[model samples]
Target: MKTVLFDYGNVVSLPQAPEDVARLASYVTGAEPGFEDRYWEVRLDFDRGSLDPAAYWSHVYGRPMDGAGLDEVVALDVASWSRPNEETVAIVDELAKVGVPMALLSNMPVCVAEGIDTLPFMRPIGPRFYSGRMGLVKPEAEIFHETVAWLGVAPGDLVFVDDRLENVAAAERAGLAAVHFRDAAALREDLKTLLG
Candidate 1:
């Protein structure tokens, strides 16, 4: 059976809002500027479970964080990534209504993934694969291969969607049918061609 695998960040969920990012930055002492850049710079390690929440925040902040301070920062970080892309979510709802098999794969840290899991839209997707939990990040062949194995599907039978071109290329390299997600309308058209 064919499985539609969706990436959570920027594909299922909206991009992190600038305001939210700024709010997160406000909590870090002596690091207000270029916070977003720093956030992304150390994100892969966090997503791959190489660094725990305290370590990840400390890396981003360039200093150690107290337990309560780390908790607040983690909460703010999770809240920043919690918004859903309504257009894409609508498509997921439509697919679910038609009984299409769907799954979610995201290079998200455990803290953020826990927040995302509580969102209502996430309920429709089966078999979510979080990088923090899997100990592997996307654009890596092993992650894609592992997902295919877990799903018990041939690589060709899994339709993977990700906003990052590198991830899409990696999925293709793993022999899965991959779509470079641009926008909701374009993605709808692509899915129609692929799923129909």
Candidate 2:
């Protein structure tokens, strides 16, 4: 493989915790109960760029928020999704040291994408594609195809790593070799074998 494409959530960043989700639900449940369900119900639309940040938050809150309230909710929402998986990041650093070509592919909203861009770990990884920016999400053949085209590499020449089985399966269907990421140790082994 000439390049390695990585999924951000769970692969590089930590997965969302149940407690975190509950906390977010609590924040906006003033007018609406079941805020958690509402938050997730429209997440795909939010991540796919179909809903703006304000609209997405409004859906969660079940009411329109003023400028200050919107900014607060946006900041909290981004923080909830921004936790890093240190072990995975270390693996990425090792790959960088060895001169491996890598790029990021993440299902994220524009607000979260902007926040991730400012992260120290993400700064080194360029040409990252966010679903919100690409207007696509994972487990879809088109996102993989579009990423391959953007990287100027053939699908067969690229290996994708994602924590989700469905996303890994989709990458294989899209003609890219894929790794179902479980831990950094396994990822190290996979990369060694693939790059050998």
lDDT of 1 at 25: 88
Highest lDDT against the true fold, candidate: 1
What's the lDDT for all of these models? 0.91, 0.85
The superposed Cα distance between candidate 1 and the true structure at residue 156, in angstroms, equals 1.0
lDDT, candidate 2, 76-171, per-residue tens: 777777888899889888888888889988888998899888888875576899999999998788999999998998888888899999999999
In order of appearance, the predictions have TM-scores of: 0.97, 0.92
Off by over 4 Å in 1: none
Report the poorest 10 consecutive residues by lDDT, candidate 2: 27-36
Candidate 2 TM-score, true structure as reference:
0.92
